[model samples]
Target: MSAGSVPWTDLDSLDIASLARRDGEKWAVAPSGVLPAWVADMDFPISPTIRQAVIRRLDTDLGYPAWFDESHGGPLGEVFARRMLNRYGFVAEPTHVRLFTDINQAMQVILHLGTEPGDGVAFHTPACPPFEDTIGKLGRIPRAVPIRLRDGEWQIDTDRLEDEIRGRQGPPCRALFLVNPHNPTGRVFRRAELLEVAKLAVEYDLMVISDEVHSDLAYPGYEHIPFASLSDEIAERTITLTSGSKAFNLAGARCAIAHIGVKTVRDAVDDHRGVLFGQVSALGVDALKAAWTSSDVWLEHVMAVLSRNRTAVAEQLPPEIGYVPPEATYLAWLDCRGLGLREEEPSDFFLREAKVLLNPGPLFGTEGTGFARLNFATPPRVLDELLRRIRGSLGC
Candidate 1:
């Protein structure tokens, strides 16, 4: 059967040997016999449409692309605008969208254009580790706003964050890096919480850099609201970033787009296009366009698999390990602190004993201690084996 018609339970899994042979960081670093459930990358194959699009391009065009000269940002811009309008009820200007190699590169350029050195960027704790590191690398201080466990749910501590922005907790922050369907812990921010953040952004006049790469993965009951879509005022200051990578398993394609709503930032980026940055490859662009336009069925299957795996993780994991199956994403942010493992980072213990590699919690920030993030995007059989090994290791 075509991949689009394949049942979610029939997810094809690569054998350990084949997976390790791949060049991606997910499996390459792990030693033999280790089941790598680490990194944000998935173990599934790419959407058939994305693969075919790239192959078609290979057989056709091999020259420098001509669409780079467009004033309206070419096919990528149009695609983004159409998707935004269709997926969410947001009316986006095609001209406001800009393409980049990936979200990190887009973030770096946006940060350079928007803020001065030493300005603070406050984002949710247990944030994406590389993003936290990127703040430091850019000579900016990262102010952590913790997402605490309350009433058995992970929710943002908006009061504490507001205090930080107001200089009551620390120096007032200049920017707020918002990660919807937040990484590590997959609590998809509700509209009320988002409105609270919007109020903070408006009141504090902070630039909002929203990373919505996981927007497409918000689970059945939760909705992923675009921060910029809240209000025109919010949109003007928000630079929304997303990619086909997380949803379509196109991480290797290296394509991302940003909706630059702030006129000043947009103007600065427009001026520097190609001269400073913004040279997306033909392959990346084509693959992203196809993934966005032609691969809904593939995404639906992937989401179904993720939904089942999310439940499986919560039920199969040892009861001592704290876990709330996320409202979104294929990642399971496990609270291993309750287990009281000898290793400071629970990932280390899992790696050594269970032969399952996971992302260490401390890397996510001060709040990630004694936690570990597991990628559950592999097939059902593989995930079963992974959980079995972990259970055996724990003597549970």
Candidate 2:
């Protein structure tokens, strides 16, 4: 797609609600109709199917939510499992699917059960800050391996990761934490890349914790290959965490599911479920079921819109910043090392001067310095304003 054909043209007319500069202030319509390209949430309204289901559920008297629990035989878990298996070609038993409030909680649960205080947990550098914080809070050392953009795609230095895992030799590298279709970078690791990483995990007897919240957002012709699908051995060692919040924009509902493929892994997760991750919300469970089973058309439309937006953003960005278009998700990681801004300063600069908020690269990791993470999920008009703000700030 030509950069010039980017969707910015249509986005020039949106009006976003404005918030107070400080907390506890009166909110009013943003007089300027500034675009909000900051948060991952989409500007487009919720899907009609999901909205109707929610409304219908509220109106109907479904007492006690027994449907969520297996005793009552609700198909929520089965629905998600089937969708995942069908899309990724990984077999997941509905019985093996356990509910969680969110993927972050699932990560904590995995950490609590799989590793000890100060145990080494491996992750790619420039990952979500929450990963590092979660590991630290759990008292595990977050060992980061960098994934650099080369040849228009992000690639992990497997040799470095393997060496680091092996060099630690004694601690045995307890777990490898990953974000397939990665967050800020938007680089979808190929199947071969996943296999090599899986091989290392098996060789070292390590757990693989993969956060695939953005899996469903993959664009046309690009498939999201679940890490578990790489091999049976890998499946045994892996815990896949995903949620409908991302693709469906249902994050506020707070529900995510874990698919534990191996008996040992399932047992491990279940054993600690009581202490760490508790029961999911009744609404979240129902929403997830509705989304996974009946939202294919909505999801396809979202993918198409985001694909167009991604191409648009790629076109507007200067080549010096070196960001290849993402294969999945609405996030775009733009390298800004050339822009003479401190790691944390540019995002703030854009927010203050350009009146646009963006995730600073530093928040992701040191490797993310001189980069900025963007959310392209807003309406086209808002997106145009965001690009204009960026262009003004950069004197482009």
Candidate 3:
């Protein structure tokens, strides 16, 4: 709809036909012309400032990374804290900030530090797969509590969460993990709603891990409240992870940060940090710095593209697919229940029949079984073609 709003150029500009040209038939995922509308990655080019910043680092010949000791208490940390506070009115102390190579590592380290074997870890359902995987792989029992979708909106099931935490049968739940402006679903919890969750966490004596990686990409007028920011009590027991990767299309850069307010929690998490784990990519650091502090023009453009893409998705998809328009993130979570397709069916149908690639809903969790997560960050033209292919496959 507007310049720089969408991430990728049109599908026709892509080699979509070539990608799926099986005996000259058009396909979307052909080896030579694969249209990767599946993952969170944006096909757009990086900002000039980020590109230059990385190049500036490469000019140093990729030497051992300089110490980020200064960053822990530096202006960068202060800037981050202030920016978040200003945006969400949730004051976070700079002393609580800790840098990391990526959020995935941060999640793992926090899980390892805060939880013990056999402890129950509760996650709001329809979440990122890694949230569940990290717990199970670490020997903690994975407990998923569903979030209710009502009136074309998504809300956490605080009642169910409370029941599980206070229930007689389950083992003591030790931790609660949240994805604010949640993944796939793109549900940006309101401030009061987040406070309710924080209250539950406090009541249960559960440690909190709030992932706000997609917070910045939120659409106009929707506010993203960080669980840790609810109050000092919550902040002290919470670990918040954020990155410029998703919002700025810099996942390849692998730079992120975690803020832990409490001394005991921070120390415990720090104990697990290894030499390789916290090592920041020099280029990644530069790119993140450029992205966070600068590139407003590029970001504005990206947001515009995402807005059009989101609108297009709502208007174009068949009635069989259902979703509330998201408040943030380029990801669209579509309910395929009406299509009579299983959780994995949409992805399979798209790849084999439509020649497109999408993230299957089930990957997020079992609750996501009859849904599909689509990336609408591509150019409008490309998105149109994707819709065309999908419609053709559905014969609708």
Candidate 4:
């Protein structure tokens, strides 16, 4: 598939009838007439390069994989390191890279190894809902550092965050969960913002689990800086988590990578590698390896569509609803507090009235109240119809 053809034409040409027939969670979970835009998964098709790689792996071998030992320059480490170097100009070591089934699993494993129960974790809230849930289930307290909508931008209150970390006067927050190209709001941290976070981590002696799963999707003029790439001191205190799934639309492939820059956490995770943590499927490895190694041209195509769609969302959305076009990702966070619906909840209101399903704001944390996240990564016609439905529901 030529980069120009697949996204510009083929993606827009996709049939919703055909998409509904597929068993993926994005389309299937919704009722027959409801257009689902709640999930982060893109409506775009997987890259052909990834498909071929998975097929080849299935055709040849299904046995136990060789990279289980987490050796240096192993299946994912070298590939991940090379990708960091080529894509972001960050010099990462193959030896520090590790693999997991998905980002969630990677987080679980890292938290289990890095912190004990009852420790406090400082995370930017209105984040991926599950991160807060994970912190709770693992028996850790959550210190919410909310990024507020100020002056037409989603800016983190760095002062509030520092207070969350330092002013509590109890045990220091053991970990800081950093989500770059932030979810719900889709704000990409500029260099100055990242430096503030790094400074806080250093002052507080906090472990930073930098989640950059959406890093590859940052649009033009928005740069993603790996937290570990800041300085050797910060690197030693950070573990950067990311995946190719979001970029290539391969979430079903279920693979994620982490560069464990801190030696003690790495040693602890390595000491218990196979028994309780750190195992990835052979096919997942192959799929991601192919994606990282060869599917960037496909990504350029997808990014083009997303850039246009992001603009479309800003241009076509109902004037009553407040929306800020995301710096990265195909998701839009809509502020619908002004709508004055009977229920005053945008997701439920839209699902009932517009027949469009969106993720509720409160799921992302209290900061998400009066907000809803809309996935704009669908085919052009489908996206247009949905936006029309939304406008129609508003009686305008």
lDDT of 4 by residue, 264-353 (tens): 888887787785764778888899999899888878988998898899898899888999989988899998989887567889889989
lDDT of each: 0.85, 0.74, 0.77, 0.86
lDDT of 3 at 35: 52
Q: How do the residues 192-244 of candidate 1 rate in per-residue lDDT, one tens digit apiece?
A: 99999999999999999999999899888888888899999999989999998
Question: Which stretches in model 4 have alpha-carbon errors above 4 Å?
Answer: 1-9, 167-170
The Cα RMSD of model 2 versus the native structure comes to 5.2
* Runs off by more than 4 Å, candidate 2: 1-14, 17-34, 67-75, 272-276, 342-344
Clashes of 3: 11
Give the C-alpha lDDT of model 1: 0.85
Which pairs of residues collide in model 4? none
Show the lowest summed lDDT stretch of 10 residues, model 2.
18-27
Better of 1 and 3 by TM-score: 1
- TM-score versus the correct structure, for each prediction: 0.95, 0.88, 0.89, 0.96
Arrange candidates by lDDT, descending: 4, 1, 3, 2
lDDT of 3 at 338: 85
Worst 10 residues of 3 by lDDT: 18-27
